[model samples]
Target: LYGLLRRNFRIEEIQLVRPDINLLQKDDGTWNLPITSSDNGAGSSKEAMMLPFIADNVQIIDGNLTWAKVGETTSLSIQNFTIRLKIHSINSFPNMDLNLSVGEMDSTMISPIKDIKANLKTSEGLASLDNLSLNISGGSIEMKGDSTLPSKDKDAEYTATISVKNIDLETLISQFVPEAKELLKGVVDADITIKGQGFDAKADIKFSIPSLLVQDKIKIEQVKGNINYADFDFIISDITMNVFGGNVVGKGTGTLANISNPEFNLAFNVNNIDTGIALTALGQDALLAQGKLSGNINASGNISDIKADGKISSDKLNIKKMGDLTDITAPFRATITKQDKEVNIDNFSAKIYGGSVEGKANIIFGKDGQPHFSTTLNLSGLEAGNALKQLAGKAFLTGKTEGNIQLAGQGTDINTLTGSTDIIFKNGKLATHPIQNLLSVFIPALKTINFVAAKFLSTIGDGKVNITTATLENPQLLMYYGKGQMKLSNQKLAIPSHLLMRCDMVAKMPLVSGAFVREDENWCGIDFNILGTLSNPKSDLGDKLKGQAIGSAIEQIFGGDKDKEDKGGGGIGDLLEGIFK
Candidate 1:
């Protein structure tokens, strides 16, 4: 009798109790239901099953529904659901009114949403959502829309306006990127309008946040922006924020089609930023530098591989590390490129250290997570003595220095450095006490001559600076040519040197004249080594000179030729005997 009734008539009103429904979504996103029946024994006709029917209403009360994709463990479920549909007809182009309320909903894509409610009216292939609201992530969302239901001949289309209020950003972001919750904290509000056909959509959004904290290190205030999204791509405009005691304005475009490696192009302008605060925000010592900074920056590419260009200027900058550079105004520019865990700063120029500096640098991260760096720099008109004193705690030379340095190293330790330098010091004085005493032993006049010039070509490695070639000159009196090495860790020196005295100057120093050999018509020279620290030196000049003097007097006395022997030892023996006595 029930089978006969099902075949002959359509039920007008239907009701369901606390039913649990399970649905499986197919590959094409259509649900598969287990409501098939075997063909009626013999007399059942295809025309009977295809006949049109009518229903006044169908209702579900206190029900649960679970939906999952084929072969997937993650599922979406609605609990405590109540739904009522007033059906006008069940034929082609049917019409209905829908009222639905869901007490709770859970999905793998996000945290649970609750208290969903909606009211809709459908007629003649058009559906109007009078109201829809939900609560998610400590926030509320309200929406209203009109949609064209798809038929065999036409596709679906929709337009909607949604407003979201006071969403907890940390909670929302953690659903997508768990680690970000530790670095970001904020509240968000937005108003959005969306329009679409089928699966394609475009949205216009205006968003604002009152405050945000990053890594508990930087505080940003009053962030607002306008964004347009289409086909997984976004255009952002008129974004403004206050951070690090400065104001920033920016704009950009990006694509989130690949969420893990989104790509972007951005430009920003910053003004009146405090350098100390900025350094502290970046996890550096605030005492490294102090100033006000202004800059313009342009950047492109994904977060992991990006390139940037910028120009920055500072006012009243003071660099504490170099000691004497204070209240300096500086203009700087650079192009920075990053890829594969490496960063390169190219074509960088700066005004610093009472000089102009130009350079390029590279930093690469090793598998051990250590940073290795290389740099090449050209410096002009730098103060040599003051900078040296700041680094080594003593000034060995004083002058205006200019140089080119190429360096490569790992970590921040100076002992790991390997590099080369070509440097010159103009109008300088070698002021170390040991050097002055060593020179005075050979030429008393040198004790008073302070003006000097010097040049050095050196290589540095293994905590030592190897002076491959060096020259120091006091043009009127003497010059020294040397090769040496200094242990940077301890400032120990060992230099083998040759000293040359000018003939005109040597002629005036009678006491030292005969002990030195005249290497050429222009000068006389001696070989000696400058050993020990710069402050205290040891040398063999006195003993060498004494031996040479004795040799010279004996040669004069012996006269090494038959004619000279005959002509004599005229007063030579007496001089020698007096010397021996």
Candidate 2:
């Protein structure tokens, strides 16, 4: 009988159950429920409907089924189920209204959803679902939607909207990002709309959050944004947030579909923010102090085409770097652009230590995808004592200093860095030195001058250092003047330079009121020369004076052979020899 009924029409094995049923369709004839058709054929088949067990309307009421099929596949099943069906003609589908519940749904392989309630209604050519609800790991959500029937080549059309409230982001983020969710605290509210036909779909969503904290170190007061998503492109707008007691505003559009050729442009502005807390919050720890920062910047494009231009300023700002605190009260400007995988810094200018510093740089990516950088810097107007203290944490000299520095290297760690620098100082005091060790080359008065003060000027460049016009005087010892040059390579020191100086010996007390010599003898200044390296330099006051004497004698000897070459050189040499004598 079942084989005959399935030849022309798709019929399910009907279980003549009367509710509270938990078994599959019974195989015995006793549980068989016969379905009959009406025959009244002028416009419709007119015939009295007769069910096998006898009487009434052509429908099933308070009926239960363990399984149902619409086609070849067994697609429906129910428990604690109640359905209303009315079938008038054998050629049309019956009206069906069903209410059912399930323990768990296993349709999604990633995670199982539980406690599903589906209320369905199908009539005419439309279908509607009401009160659809499910539970996820973090929270619960509800959905409502409707759909139209589909034909051969055309797909069903549908519209759906979802609401999410106070979902636990920690739980959600841990499943995806697998980082700490406990160090964070926040609540999320979102509204989502999805509409699709066939294989194409679009989504519009909005989010609002308040009082979010990360590791309890940084806090955001409010955040609001919206996104329009289609395919792989997104348009974001009206983004606003608060951090470090300042406001941040931004907007942009981008496409991540093609990673090699991304396009983006975002203009951002920040106002009167605390630099220390802001830097800390952004994962930097330079220990900035006593400054408020405000700036506007534009960031865009992929790595090969990235660019940035901005101006930043601070008032009386102090930064802790390399275990020293440096102060600055100046404005900074920077412009950067990238081309052919090389990043270029067109200009970077700032002021420090009552001076100005300016430079340019280039960064190229290596085979390992790390940056290799080369840069040049020029510094001026910096105090000698301050610059020394900033670089070495100790001040040995005091005056004004200027310098040029060049650097080139790769890697992110400072330990793997390399560079070279040059410096010059003028009119400074030597706070401390090894002057006593240099008594062989300098006068005894150098100790007293080093103890109190001195005048000095020096210039260094290209691995070579020169010192000129360093003078010292003392009544107890003698007056000394000096100049020299030195060189360095790979931090190894070598000096091959010359120095010319004069020393004055003072005669005082007048023998305690007894007697004395001439006025020139009271403070006899001598001519001298210094030779050799900074490590072991040699002085020759006797030789320099003797040379002057010989040169003078030779000049007199050649007075008859006077060529235009001497001009006043010989005259000046004669005057110096007479004064020294």
Candidate 3:
């Protein structure tokens, strides 16, 4: 053999019989060969001893190899491998065919793969995988591919198609994402095509699923979609699913170029969604509301920032609270937008209690993750008695009301409230028992007075509500005016007020009318203070009359000066001036 040619050689056949080999892989994915001192010396003269050979055929039979990496429990074993090579000449590339059958392949990162079989062929620098099949996690995967080796002038190019069928989602995904095991259950299928040159690659993926259950709360049915990826970006289309008794369709685009802060733009349309089911899916009590909901949403953003716009509407929403159900008869509609930690709602409209409401609102999240909100609402022709009974479980007044309210607050506490309200009532009467009881002390006829018109104006801040003006008019009887502040935290009232009546009306009830002082030939007035909580009020009219005569008390209360009486400084002139001012 030493005397034979080393530059050119020919062999008809060579065989490897029942060989077993073990190889170590380095961290960088390169093999680490076992070399002794003598083997090293021989390898140093490898170029001089190298031979170019021509073989008609060569084969390896019953070969077994185990490959393992340093400091890792994961390893791959190939068994019962057979290979055949056919060579025509030393200058021509050989043809090779190989088949591998593995009884079992196991790794810590995935479940064992069983009954693996593969067939591969090669000519020159090109290799083709005719078929590769494996069973894993109660499912199977089939794959085929063609690849070319890289040369000095070009990068490797490859194409592959993979088919996955009925893979156990929880069993498979739990190996990589353990936390999701309890949150997910289902089976999945996919057909994927991948093509690439070196690191520049693209994939087209189509996936389908019969059903998926998430967190034991939501069930998604008939999910199907297709996605295309190229240049680190993904385009998704034709995605549809059913959940919450509704159908949803969606499309989107996303980028993975900067994976830490990847961006996405997505849109979704939902139709005929059951509101109770949707609320329950979001961890809320289903009894809160019931109706059908429809919506469209568009969103764009990166991980830490987002912007969204949408519209939502419903026609038959009924709210349930405290064993009561309130029907909203008109269609409900709202437009919503969000940026970062702030959300804005616009063009919100609804009808209830035979009245219409229109409003806009804004919400902001602070650094501490607490929410602050503000809103303005206009009400038209609302039945006050019905509104009060529905909202408060008691009817405090009966009338038709129109008003506008502007309010801002933090969290859910009413004590943080700051706002203003102006309201007008038509053809109404006070139904509060405490207020009626207090008024009866002034005049027996005041116990059940009906007002033709009433108005209230107030502003809220600093833990108190400032009553800028409050008036009631009964054209046939009397007029009333009041001003005061109410403590918001406790609903306590402190108001100074006056009741003015025509002398003719007073003369009709002379017994209780003694408390009224004649302010003029035509008018009689009684000044009093309203005290106590909003639910239980008290008056000081009896004490004032007992302490002094009605005329002297009235004069003293108004800074009496008979000498300035003619200058519009006292009596009816002064009382009207003070009330209006």
Candidate 4:
């Protein structure tokens, strides 16, 4: 009968169960049964021979049977005919009152079961399976009350309440992402419970499938966890996950739709989590830093669309062969939303370096599974020079540099960032090191000016520059454009004595402090324009004694009866070329 039923009904599995019904009789002689299985099978050989069994009147109330196809079962011949079965049940059971239904079923080798229900035994706590109704067309199976044992111990008493209302955890998840159910098959567990209006339940749900072939792409090992969802709250505890040796423990809750929005309060602490191994678990690359990081994150958000606020700090992050000993501590707040074909980040802000970076970003997936996104960052009061050195191991400037930048970008990929920024520098100085070669040769004689003072005011005059763009493209600036002024002071030019003799002029001597010095008091002032590129500037200095020399030379050339005239000091040439003429 077992082999005939396994072949006829297409039952692919079967198991024989031993009875575990212990009945206790009361002393009242009324046979008050604590628990009992009423025997309806053949009582004895003599009684079985006396009564002719009628098949129409006899029906097995609570029963169980396991049926499975053996080896070499081809798809064409592996239909309902290939299933082999063996029956198992409490031989006899007394049902005072009974109501049962098939809750779910596993998928068949060929057809998918959309919905299923089975009769349950609630009398002796043995939970005998009665009948099963399955929808084998779609890949959805739902079994009712005590269909599958909590553990491999078949005789264990089942005491869990079962209530399911519109429950399709896998189906719901598949709607959002068809592969989500497959990805989370072993990565996550969905424990569902429905409790309201004087009803409650608790169930241990497991999605921890070791060696779970995800979409037949990658094989994961030691992925296991348990979830408890009941009474308007859900929690997952004692979660020991595996990814090159790591663990995660937390509790989460929300409405019971796998892909639907669910708010969850989570807390997790990681230990020795190999970033490379962890990222590989999620199908991503791991960029390692200086030291290992260990911290706990407290976040609350929905499953599909979540709002998380947490803080993660590191001792020192190593960016491989670069400078180290850098510490970053930041608090981030962000809201994640999911659309029909994409995910979005709204109001994402984090305090990084010395400034607050705020922005909104999004990732849109096309039909071909390609993701594109755009992000705009508003960074205020950032110390750019210091940040650049920390992130890239090179400084953009050296001396007291500080600024604010407003940047924006859009791209399909996150690696190759494309953006524009408007940066403003105040009292910022590019230290005199990188550009020392270019600037040192210009003022070779002016050795005292070791540092260029780009200030609001100068000792010569008011000095300032409005640098439109200070871009550093390695050894060259893409565009250098600015305007500034270099003022000249009212100081006398100390010319060499050899250059003075070429003038052929003289001036009256002015006696002061017991020393006589040539004085040209009328021609003491000279002015010049200072403007141009940093490499060169416009300037000119005129000789002050030229006027006196011209007058003296003409008189000497036209002399006929020149009187003994003291035109101020001695002869025409002498007077004209005196210290003061």
In candidate 4, what are the lDDT values of residues 13-119, reduced to their tens digit?
33323322222334432233322234457562221111111111223223332333334232221112111222232223222123332223233333333334445
Tell me the deviation in Å of residue 470 in model 1. Answer: 3.4
In model 3, what lDDT does residue 413 have?
63
**True lDDT of residue 3, candidate 3:** 37
Can you write out model 3's per-residue Cα lDDT over 228-270, one digit (the tens) per residue? 9898899987688888898889999999887545678888887
The model with the greater lDDT, 1 or 3, is 1
| Candidate 2 vs candidate 4, TM-score winner | 2
What does candidate 2's lDDT look like per residue over 41-92, in tens digits?
A: 5655433332222112222334434543223343234333333333222323
Q: Counting only residues 3 or more apart in sequence or on different chains, how many pairs clash (N, Cα, C under 3 Å) in candidate 3?
A: 0
Pick out the ten consecutive residues of candidate 4 with the lowest summed lDDT: 496-505
For each candidate, the alpha-carbon lDDT, in order, equals 0.74, 0.52, 0.73, 0.37
TM-scores for all candidates: the values are 0.72, 0.51, 0.62, 0.42
RMSD, candidate 1, Å? 9.5
lDDT, model 3:
0.73
User: Cα deviation of 99 in candidate 3 (Å)?
Assistant: 4.3
The true-versus-predicted C-alpha distance at residue 400 of model 1, in Å, is 3.8
Residue range 1-581, candidate 1, lDDT tens digits: 33454453566898998899998888855557423333466664222323244567878998999989987777899999999988776555557888998999999878899999999988888989999999998998999999998865677899999999988887887777554555568889999999998768899999998998866657888999999999989999778999888988999999988765667888889888887887677555677677777788777886445676666666456666554333333233333322124656666566654666677888775554455789998888876676677765667667788889899987556698999999887887666545555456556666654446778899999999999988878767678798999887776888898888888776674544665679888888778887776444566665555455456555665545666447654444444344323
